[model samples]
Target: MTATTDESAFAAENAFGKGEPNIAYAQYFTGDSFLNNLVTDPECVVGVHNVTFAPGCRNNWHVHHATSGGGQVLICTAGSGWYQEEGKDAVSLTPGVVVFTRAGVKHWHGAKADSWFSHIALGVPGENTSNEWLEPVDDAHYAAL
Candidate 1:
């Protein structure tokens, strides 16, 4: 489905309730999305968040970097979505599918054109862990999928 189509559908429930507004840094995403931090305690080594993407919503290419070890893991919890690493084929995401993106990889993920999707993103902690958000995915490239 094209991102601009009118047939988009949203499931009754997409995992844990769509938490608070995303409040993502404006430069990081191309469309609407939300983020719900699930593990914020200082003692927790892993950061957990529930991300909900509106139909056709997607973030820009980014990387989770760490000097030794650290990356990001996305566990699909509801609806449908897509994930793609730089120079790799786009992967369909459904409930239970897990995408583990190792550190230093450039990747992007979001809801499909016609579906609202949700997933739990686990942030693996490591020395000097940081996120680097890059350019948005172009429309032509995204529509080709």
Candidate 2:
């Protein structure tokens, strides 16, 4: 279903629960998104967070750069979405779907035009790991999906 402005409705629909507004990275997104941290202890090996996207919302193309073993893992939790790597076809996202994005792989993901979406993101541990946010996904390209 499409996104709703009603905070209660969104909370009831999202399983993992929504956190605060994603104001810190708003510039990288096309629409509203929320971030809820599942793991925040510094001792934790992997950084885990639950991300909820409003309908038609998506992040810009980005990469996780690492000199060693570094990458990202996305566990789809609710509604529908799309994920695409550079030069590759987009992958459909639904509950239980999992995506493994290796370091340096240019890619982008977001909710489908008519659906709200949520996913749990895991940051793989690695040496010299850094994130590079790039250009937003083109409007025409997203519309064609």
Candidate 3:
């Protein structure tokens, strides 16, 4: 389904709330997604956000690079999804599930074909942290799921 800011049943069930369109990173995603900033205070060391993904929507393969200790933590809050790393098996995501991706790990995550997915993403603090977006997951690769 097309992604929009309209309140969906998934959004109503999600406690964190469905946010606005994720325009800044739209090019990196296969379908529609939303981003809600949970921590907007500049003084906050950790960056926290609630990401809502439409059915069949997923981001491209990417990496979070850092010189020291940067990484990402995803806490599934609503619906179901899948998280996979390069050369590894894809993990199923459900509410209460948590996944930690270390710095420089090539990975991708998104909603399943028939379900919406929401996760709270925590940016781990580190030095010289940057994100590198890579190629899309591709239809064949995603269909295999």
Candidate 4:
């Protein structure tokens, strides 16, 4: 399933509060990770989640899609991490960095081998929004990063 962390670790490393970690749904991720629902506004078409990844924790390749227009944005709020799209070089993540994975792009994001990481995940709302989860990021691929 999911992993738990000592709250102090995040408190010292992150700019934002590392709210209680939610059991990262098994259907979506690989290794250990947690989620904090920071904001959910259905009316304004916006939602934000704080996600924490212990060292080496990551999710599988996935896609966010919408019939009209929508995708996902990640605002790095703490520590170090990695983000990669299918067939592209992995980008390093740190505080103040923002990543925009447009709808229909296959990608994955997670912590580095020796560092914990957190990001504020923003959901860009659109009609017919949905997520497509695919295979895990292989160990070999990650090890090289």
Q: Candidate 1 residues 56-82, lDDT tens each? A: 888999999999789999999887889
Cα displacement (angstroms), candidate 4, residue 86, comes to 0.6
Candidate with more favorable, higher TM-score: 2 or 4: 2
Better of 1 and 2 by TM-score: 2
What is candidate 4's TM-score against the reference?
A: 0.87
Better of 1 and 4 by lDDT: 1
> TM-scores across all candidates?
0.90, 0.92, 0.94, 0.87
Candidate 2 vs candidate 4: the lDDT winner is 2
lDDT of 3 by residue, 8-84 (tens): 76766689987999999999999999999998999999999999998899999999999999999999998888999
Which residue runs of candidate 2 sit more than 4 Å off their true CA positions? Answer: 1-10
Q: Model 4 Cα displacement at 103 (Å)?
A: 0.3
- lDDT string, candidate 4, 24-133, tens digits: 46667766777787765556568788888878889999999898778999999887889999989999998888999899999999988877789999889888999989
Best by TM-score: 3
Residue 85 displacement (Å), model 1: 0.3
Candidate order (lDDT): 3, 2, 1, 4
Model 2 TM-score is 0.92
lDDT digits (tens) for residues 42-143 of candidate 2: 889999999989889999999999999999999998778999999999999988899999999999999988777889999999999999999999999999
Model 4 misplacement above 4 A: 1-9, 40-44
Better of 1 and 2 by lDDT: 2
lDDT of 3 at 128: 99
